[model samples]
Target: MTDPLLTTAELTAFLARDFEQVKDDFTVDEITAQGIKLRLNVAERHLRPGGTVSGPAMFGLADVGAYLAILSRIGLEALTVTTNCSIDFMRKPIAGKDVICDVRLLKLGRQLAVCDALVFSDGDDRPVARASLTYSIPPK
Candidate 1:
């Protein structure tokens, strides 16, 4: 396995500097050979009328987690964009708890990277959502 090109601190800093709007919403918990672990701190804004975490909120976490996982291996490519994403909302996420996303990079090629993310509510062993993402890496 190859060493990660970006550390959690570096990825956090990059998000803060480039994506300030969501900088506070996400925390990079760890980066490993498999992929990255991210936490989404739940807030009032992320809740739904049903007293559960909203789907869009979870989707955002999955997307960001996948992006960071790819960047960890390929280095920061700001222009790298999601080419496709398919997500399944398996279960409703608990409110008032942080959502954790375990992202795995399944494949990385010259022009694209494929990843999968499993999102779980804090303290829960079951996944609430699953996402498969493909990103187009910008040409150097």
Candidate 2:
């Protein structure tokens, strides 16, 4: 398979013009041929009572990661929107650590893309969660 856009600079530029929340909530830390790295600034709203990252917060990270992965390969296509997401909370994520997602696109076709995420706490390689996402791409 051909490589996608593999640089933080490119990811950020794509996000700025298309995905505004990427500027507000996430940092495109790294991008590579295998996948991409995404960091979430976990704040109070992103925490549960036990000082763990909330489900919605992790969901957002995974969702955005998948979206970015698609854009990385296909270029800026803002109309691509999530159609479905199934997430598994594998472990309790540390509260303060930035949530990271390593996302890979499983399928990229004419009208749809499927992707998955292995989410982790900063400094931890083990995944705290896994999510499979489907996005609908607008007709070009």
Candidate 3:
């Protein structure tokens, strides 16, 4: 795979600039040869009534993770938007722990991108959720 167009620091800065509302909740962990690792810094608002992470929160994690991975490869393009997301919540997240998503870009084309993310509670071997996503990329 080619080196990413955006580094972790560059992606972080882009998030801060474009997605200020959620910028504080996520961190770019690392850019691996395979994909990008994103961490969701869980806070009180992210928990559900049963002390598990909310479905919407996990969805956000997966969505943002996928978005960042695509941006890493394609550069910080704000016009790239999620076209579809199908997610499965398989297990409850561990309370008091942050969540991590390992994001992989399945395909990247001039006009579209496909990706997926496996969500796990910090320190867990099993995934709590998984998501497959597609994004529409602006033409070059």
Write model 2 residue lDDT over 74-140, tens digit each, in one string: 7778788999999999999976898999998788888999888999999998899999999999988
List where candidate 3 sits over 4 angstroms from the true fold.
none
> Mind giving the per-residue lDDT tens digits that candidate 3 earns over 93-115?
99999999999888888999899
RMSD of each: 0.8, 1.8, 0.9
Error of 3 at 78 (Å): 0.7
Q: All models: lDDT?
A: 0.94, 0.85, 0.92
Q: Write the per-residue lDDT of candidate 1 for residues 55-93, one digit (tens) a residue.
A: 999999999999999999889899999999999999988
TM-score of each: 0.97, 0.89, 0.97
Model 2 spans > 4 angstroms off: none
Residue 12: error of model 2 in Å? 1.6
Q: After superposition, how far is residue 134 of candidate 1 from its true place, in Å?
A: 0.2
Q: lDDT score, residue 91, model 2? A: 91
Cα lDDT for residue 16, candidate 2: 77
